[model samples]
Target: MSTNNQNDVVSHAINAAQANAEDSQAQQQVEELSSMLQSSTADANVDTSSEE
Candidate 1:
């Protein structure tokens, strides 16, 4: 193949890798946030119950 085609392939590969990494990071963030929300909700419930 020509040099330009080779460069295009390389560029596409880099972009795909970056996209995958970003998606993985986003998933991790969502998981962490979900856990934090669940923990905070449980704590709030416990505190409110104790006050009654």
Candidate 2:
């Protein structure tokens, strides 16, 4: 294989890896936020029910 082609392939692979890492971190943050929201929602519901 030519040097230029090899370098292009490596560059593409590095970009893909970086994109995947960013996406995974974003997904984890979303999951964490969802969990926190659900917990707060449950607590709020309990408080409302108790007020009745």
Candidate 3:
């Protein structure tokens, strides 16, 4: 392959890898937030029940 073609391929690969890493990080954050919300909701339910 020509030098220019090789450079383009490498650049594309790097960009794809960076994007994948970003997506993974976002997914992890979402999961963490979901877990926190669920925990808080459960606690709230317990408190309400006890007050009844």
Could you say which candidate leads in TM-score?
A: 2
Q: Residue by residue across 1-52, what tens digits does model 3's lDDT show?
A: 5445654665565555556656778667655655665566567657766887
Q: Which ten residues in a row have the lowest lDDT in candidate 1?
A: 2-11
Model 3 worst lDDT run, 10 consecutive residues: 2-11
lDDT of each: 0.61, 0.61, 0.60
lDDT of 1 by residue, 1-52 (tens): 6445654665565555556656778667655655665566567657866887
Taking every candidate in turn, the Cα RMSD to the unseen true structure, in Å, is: 20.0, 20.0, 20.0
Question: Which is the better candidate, 2 or 3, if ranked by TM-score?
Answer: 2
Candidate 1 lDDT = 0.61
In terms of lDDT, model 2 sits at: 0.61
C-alpha positional error of residue 49 in candidate 1 after TM-score superposition, expressed in Å: 0.9
**Cα lDDT, model 1, residue 7:** 48
Question: How many clashes in each structure?
Answer: 0, 0, 0
Model 3: pairs clashing at backbone N, Cα or C within 3 Å: none
